[model samples]
Target: MRWGVLGASAAISRRVMPAIAAGGPTTLAAVAGRPQSAARTTEVAAAYGARAHHDYGALLADPAIEAVYIALPNSEHVGWTLRALDAGKHVLVEKPMALSEADAVRVQEAADAARRTVMEAFMYRFHPQQRRAADLLASGEIGDLRVVRASFAFLMGAAPGDIRLAPGLGGGATWDVGCYAVDAAMLHFGRAPRAVRAVLSRRPGADVDTSGTVLLDFGEGRSAVLDHSMDYGPRSWMELQGTHGSITIRNAWAGADEDGTLTVLGYAGTREESVPAADHYRLQVLALTDAARAGTPAPIPLSDSLRTVRVLEAVFASAADDGAAVPVAEEGTG
Candidate 1:
């Protein structure tokens, strides 16, 4: 598969682009960046041996590019994804596919209309450790799952112009890091939440949240507790507690050369397993490329993206209401 990148962001230059070059049966054909960053874009493209286009449309128009990785900011995800689909190119967009459920549905409709594959770039989902954990849950090694606790946080420097702290750019602790916890919970429970209640903390004069805690009720005594922050010490992990035992995953989201661990405790005994280090980004690229070639559904379908966004919407609403519980709207409805 031949690929084009829509931005010259750090993630693109340092991770996905390199993954494309080394990932199986894929080529880094082109890259596009804003006109103001033409030099940086050219430098990035040259490093990867790909053509550079200052305008995103020019890269999309390239006949040799079969798919595109949209690394633009959260606000630009939906628009660029729709444009890429319209250009007859498959899309693998960054996480939080949309800031809202409506935009996610729009992207889904456009992808279906274009008969193109579209996937959210939740690279961690492609990691082998995730699969192992899922298998353990499926095998009933942890009886019936009753609760999930997940958190992802890191300190953000007091930079005045960081995009993650900009409201207009869809920046917030929940949107930036909380989505991973929400996604992990949903992945384990295999269903969307029924309701959500959240509380957020914002620094003085800041319009966006710097930290938040959310409770998702999945009904029937099943639930997830999630918390995220941009002003906390680094921590990332998820634990699933069940009737019989529990499973804890350390560093749940593995990056390049980062190995994770899974510990399962039950009536039988406590066992710890080491997950081999792997580049999930490379795995993600290969998976999407293979799916595109086979003309099959995306590895991470748009519907899943919609559910995640719906839950996020409920979280934000609840926070705005002073932590009052908010019901998550059903799919295809308001």
Candidate 2:
């Protein structure tokens, strides 16, 4: 898969671009950045032997590029994805594919019409530990799954200019980090929650949330508790509790090499499962490329992306209403 990157963002430089450079069925063909960042973009592209474009449209116009990796800001995800699809290119877009379920639906419709593959870039899902954890839950190693608790928090510098602190750019701790926790819960439960409630904390004079705690009701006495923050010290972990036992994963989101662990505590005794070090970003790239070549649905389908946005919308609504319980919108509903 010949790939073009839509931005010269830190994520692109630090993770995805390196993954693309790593030997696989994928290659870095080009990179595009705004005029102000042209030099940096050129440097990044040259590091991997790919072309660089000052304009996103120019990169899209490059016929040699078969796919696009959108590492743009959260607010730009939907528009670029739609544009990439119209350009006859498959897209692997950064998470929070759309701020709303409605926008996600539009991207889904566009991708289907274009007959191109589109995937939300949730790299952690491709990690072996995530799959192993899921398998353990499915094999009844954790008995009947009852509850999920996830937390992803990290302190951000008090830089007022950071994109993460800008409301108009879809900036917020919830959108940036809480989405991971929500996705983890949904992945394990395999269904959308019926309702959600959340309490948010915001810095004075800032419109975006700095921290939040959300509750997802999955019915049948099952639920998920999620918390995220940009004001707290670094913490990332998820725990799944069941009738008989529980599974805990450390470094659930940041899958650095050999830095993750999955511990299972069941009826028999406590045991730690060894999850080998692996580059999930490269795994994601390979998976999407293979699926695109085979004309199969993306590994992270648009429907799943839509469901996650729906849940996020509900979370925001509940937070705005002072933590009132907000019901998640069903598919095809406004």
Candidate 3:
């Protein structure tokens, strides 16, 4: 499979693009963006020896591009993902996949009808440390699943007119960073929470949340807590606690080094440990390629992402009601 990038988003140009360049099954083919930004896109693509286009549609229309990565702002996710899928291109879109559940459903429906793969790019899930964390839980390192606490946050800093603070760009800690925390909790628990509640701090007159706390109740049996912030300081931390032992993942969001020598706080000892894979993004690309080639569902199903949206929506709703707990969707999320 040959992959094309929809825009020269920093994440792609830096972390994600380098991993794809590290040589998995597929090759980077081309990158595209608005003409005003294509110069930078072209520069990055040239560094990788790939073609560059000024028009995004033209890039998608290119017959050689089998798969494409959509790294646009959060608000543009649904439209571009659907467009790419409709153009007969498989997609790896940045999370959260859409601004609303309806948009996510539309994107997934388009993919289903086209028999194309559309994966939400929660790249952290592809890391071997995450799998290792899961393994630790399964191996009874943590006696019985009790509580999972994860946080992914950092100060976006004061960038005047930045999209992160603008409501129209789908900017906010909730969609920007909170989604990762939610994704981590859901993935660790391996199911939607039984109930969710949130507390959000909003900038005056801004329609977006800057920082928030999400409390997820798995059931009478388990619970997960996640916190996200766009202001404060730099931090990426996670811990899983149970009856026996616990697991700690420092720098969980950004991923570890190639050998997966991430600082793991566990029974193995609190030191850097080597995981199987080298690069998280490469693993994600490889998974996407295999899923697209096999005509099967993504490793993380689209419905799972939709369910997350429902959870976020419920969080906001609950917050609106002064943090009253709200149940996750019971059924019908196609």
Candidate 4:
């Protein structure tokens, strides 16, 4: 598959693109950006051996580009995803697929009608380390699942006008990083959350959250706590506790830099596993190719997205109600 890029944020340009370049059955074909960003994208494309264009339409209209990676701001995900599907190009959009669930569904419906792929890029799930964790959890080494706790945060010491603080841009820790925690918890539990409660910190003039903590209950007496922030030190980790022992994975969410540790303790014994660095984007691209060519399922399916969006919506409702607990229902799909 020949791929094009829709704008290059620091994260996308430096981290994701390199992984895409190394992925199987996929090649970087072109890059599109704002008119003013054309020059930078051009230089990047040249360095990566891809074409470059000034507007989104030009890239979408490019015949050589069979797929496009939407690395634009969060708010642009829905619009561009729908447009890319309509233009006959597969899309792998950055996560928190859209600002709202309705928009996410619209993207999915467009993809279904076109028979094209519209995927949410949650890179951690593609990493081998994540798969290892999943295997360990499924083996019941941690015994019957009970609770999951995860956190992702980093200093946003951003420039005065950085979009991470712009609500209009769909910028916030909840949409930015909390999605990962939520995804992990939901997938690990293999069910949608039953209730959600959250506290979002916001300041005047800032339309997005600076930081927040959310709680998810999956019933069966199981629950999870998720913490996210845009104005804090770097932290990414998770833990799962069961009836017998516990499994702790330090830096669980930061799969790209798998310089983390995994600990499993039980009546049998205790083991510490050192996870080496892995290219999550390469894994993601490979999975996408598998789904497209072999008719394999997406690593993160549309229904999983629906439940996640539902959880996020409930979180918003809870936050809007000043942290009132909100109930979440089971979804028809994972």
lDDT on C-alpha atoms for all candidate structures: 0.91, 0.90, 0.82, 0.83
Which residue runs of candidate 2 sit more than 4 Å off their true CA positions? none
Model 2 per-residue lDDT tens digits across residues 10-84: 767888898887866888989999999989999988888999999999999999999999988899999999999
Tens digits of per-residue lDDT for model 3, 10-91: 7678877776666658888898988998679789889998899898999999999999988888888999998898899999
The residue-level lDDT of candidate 3 at 157 comes to: 61
- The parts of candidate 4 lying over 4 Å away from their true place are 203-205, 255-257, 332-334
Clashes of 1: 0
Write candidate 4's Cα lDDT for 281-306 as tens digits.
Answer: 88887777668766556778887888
Error of 3 at 242 (Å): 1.4
Candidate 3 regions exceeding 4 Å error are 203-207, 256-277
After aligning candidate 3 to the native by TM-score, how far in Å is the CA of 98 from where it should be? 1.2
Give candidate 1's TM-score: 0.98
As a whole number from 0 to 100, the lDDT of residue 235 in candidate 4 is: 87
The residue pairs in collision within model 1 are: none
To one decimal, what is the Cα RMSD in angstroms of model 1 from the true structure? 1.1
lDDT of 1 by residue, 1-334 (tens): 8999999987678988989988459999899999999999999999989999999999999989999999988999999999899899999998879998889989989989998999999998988889899999999989999999998999987788888888999998889999999999998998888899999999777789999999999999999998999889598888999999999998887677888899999999999999898889988899888898898987788889999999999898999999999998776676
Deviation (Å) of 164 in candidate 2: 0.5
Clashes of each: 0, 0, 0, 1
Candidate 1 local lDDT, residue 32 = 98
List per-candidate RMSD values in Å: 1.1, 1.1, 2.5, 1.8
